[model samples]
Target: MKKILFTGGGSAGHVTVNIALIPRFAREGWTIDYIGSTNGIEKQLISSMPHVNYHSISTGKLRRYFDLQNVKDPFRVVRGVLQAYRIIKEQKPNIVFSKGGFVSVPVVMGAWLNKVPVIIHESDLTPGLANQIASRFSTRICTTFPETVNAFNNRKSRYVGPVVREAIFHGDAARGLAFTGFSKSAKPTILVMGGSLGAQKINRMVREALPELTKHFRIIHLCGKGQLDPTSTHPDYRQYEYVNEELPDLLALCDFVLSRAGSNAIFEFLALKKPMLLIPLTKQQSRGDQLLNAASFERSGYCKVLQEEKLTPQTLVSQLREVSWDKDEYIQNMSRFQQNDALALLHQLITETAK
Candidate 1:
């Protein structure tokens, strides 16, 4: 039986790609195993997959600071790498596919040491450091943005758009409100989300600006797990930590969207044909290249970039009140630009290289 190992998790951006790629791998008669950081969101997500054998290693983040915490992390990496090596040895998987969060480091490093083919897929216009560092040894690197090639030193990088779930490619805007519980009659159904943790700055602005926002459009505010204040109320506002059942349907109905510029969120919004306003986190190192992503999309006319520091209730209300999207151009650009075959390509590349 064919077996492949995959790594990367912590956020939905990492987990979602695994979700998107796994079904395709299964269909092609391959068994998938997952390696992730212990006690993280990845464990919760992958544990339920019947065909996936999940393993967790003690891992930590890669930081730019020269702190005592940084000094303490090498032992974690040593332990993680050793654990990953043992998992790989037991599974003897054909290949390892990575989506470059710090969790992926040991998995790919172990896979390389074990002579397993390693492939990395990056889902941003700017590649993450984990991916870039891993790419040095990756058999191949796949990227969503063609322009991102300059960000990598790997020559084997392929310009493949993000591998979104099959559900997203088939989203229907007409029935979106039914799924999100907003008004189908509402001309613009704005979906507002700020990554999994929710952007406090954006959420605060939206909360302050809600009265004005509701005047122009019904809103779906997917406040991250703990971000909502619980005091805000609106007849036209739907709020949640997450909505899994009908996300695609809700996305389809959205006429406008406000979200963080995380790689997955950007691709998902583009797939749904929703024009966007991106509020990238400007928090310290999290400034970790999101600004570049926001700038790129803003320049392309696909999204309006809003800085977290600069976003205010008045600014958001003023913009949302008058902003009009070029639906035709958006649809055309997104359809032509989207690489819907990302999962298939990953499956093919990993399977081929594994042999």
Candidate 2:
């Protein structure tokens, strides 16, 4: 039987694209193998998939800051490369696909050593450190944004637009309302997402402004693990550490979104036509990718940008109000966006590239 090896981890964004493509390959009777760090979130996300054979390896984060771990991580990455090489050699997969995270670098190198064709997907406007390294080893580079195509300056880069999950498009608004216990006759609902791990600053400010905010909109906050505030309670407000199957319902329920500027999440929001108030991570917090993503979205009129550096309870409330007021205009801009069939394109690329 034909087989394929996939690798990406460290964050939900890295694995979500793989998740969207996996079911398609499985339905076609292809054997699927996944490589990820032992305790990373990818393991938890992929563990429930019965058809996928999951393999764990040592992984080192590609950090920009000085830390004691930086000295030790190179050794771990080398170990991961060797382990990945052995696994790829044994599995002899026809092709390896990567979604561009720290864990994926070793996997791409292993695929190169094994003489297997590799395809890497970049979700950000500019490539991350891991993807930049993997790009040299990859047979082709798939990008979510059209501008990223020019960054490569090579024949390998292809713009496939965004690969959004099919389930996201099938959300039920009524179910969402029921799940949140929100009333249709009451205030509009706003979903606050701080990413998979949550954003502390955003969380704090949201709660701080709840007294003024709840008067205008009911709130549903996905506060990330261990970030929940017990003191903040209201008739119209609800908070979750995270949501799995229920996320679609929550997305369906919200009339507006307050979120961090992660590329994957923003694209999904854009696809859903949800007006968003984006507070991107500051340059110190990230490599400024979120800043660029938010800026791009703002330029396109799909969302309003709120810099985290300037984030305060008052600013949050004001920006959200502006987004709500300009909601129809944002929707009109989003309506003009036509995304290609990214999943199908990737499937075809893999099928054609695989030996």
Candidate 3:
């Protein structure tokens, strides 16, 4: 049987695309393996897959800011590269597929050193620092946005769009309603997501808006790990730390979305044709990639963007109302794009490159 190795994850966004591709490869009878940080979210998510062999290596965070850890992380990264090199040499997989993250940098480098073909997928409008470094060692780079193609300026860059999980399309609305204790006779349901780590600012604003919002909408809040408000007992509000298996059903039940503008999460919402009000991370919190992702979605009529700095309880409720009013138009515009082809193209690239 053919064998393939995958690597990515500091956050859920980096690992989700790889998750979407795993089953397809498994069905085709490829022996699949994954290399990630020992305690990263990727290890938690991918380790449970029955068909995937998961390997953990030492990895360090790639930070743009100066800190004491910055001086020490380079050494960790070097160690990670050596650890990855040993894994690649032993596994001898046909190809290495990377969803770019700090963990993926060493894996891509190790693959290059082993003379194995490496394909890296970038889900942002512009490459992250890890991907920027991995791109040099990769044989091909797949992008989710057309705008990202020009940024690479490399002949290997291909714009294939985002890979959405198959399970997302098979959501059961009944199961979703049951999970949230929402009724059809009640107000419309809106799902609020703050990304993998949960955005405290967005969570705070949503809680503040609940009194007004619950009058017109039932809320299903995925509040991130350990961020739940235990005192919240609103009849129309439900809170979760996170949902893995039930997420598709939750998406099916939601009439709209209030979310961060991470490319993977937003694209999944877009594919489901859920109207969204996006509050991207500001420059103070991130490299501003979420801002660019939100702007692109807004420009294409896929969602509404609310600048984080301008956010308030009143503004949040107003934007939610606006998104409801404009929901059909956003769905109509999203319908014009073929969102499902991304996985097929990416799978083909990996298969052909492996040969």
User: Each model's TM-score?
Assistant: 0.92, 0.98, 0.98
Candidate 2 has a TM-score of 0.98
Model 3: how far is 158 from its true place, Å?
1.1
Summarize candidate 3's per-residue lDDT along 5-115 as a digit string, tens digits.
Answer: 999999999999999999999999999999999988899899989799999998988999988999999999999999999999999999999998899999999999999
Q: Per-residue lDDT of 180-250 in model 1, one digit per residue for the tens? A: 66554635778898876677778888888988888877888888877767788887888887766467777
- Clash pairs for candidate 2: none
State how far residue 203 of model 2 sits from its true place (Å). 0.4
lDDT of 2: 0.92
Root-mean-square deviation per candidate: 2.2, 1.1, 1.1
lDDT of prediction 1: 0.79
Worst 10 residues of 2 by lDDT: 179-188
Among all windows of ten consecutive residues in candidate 3, which has the lowest summed lDDT? 179-188
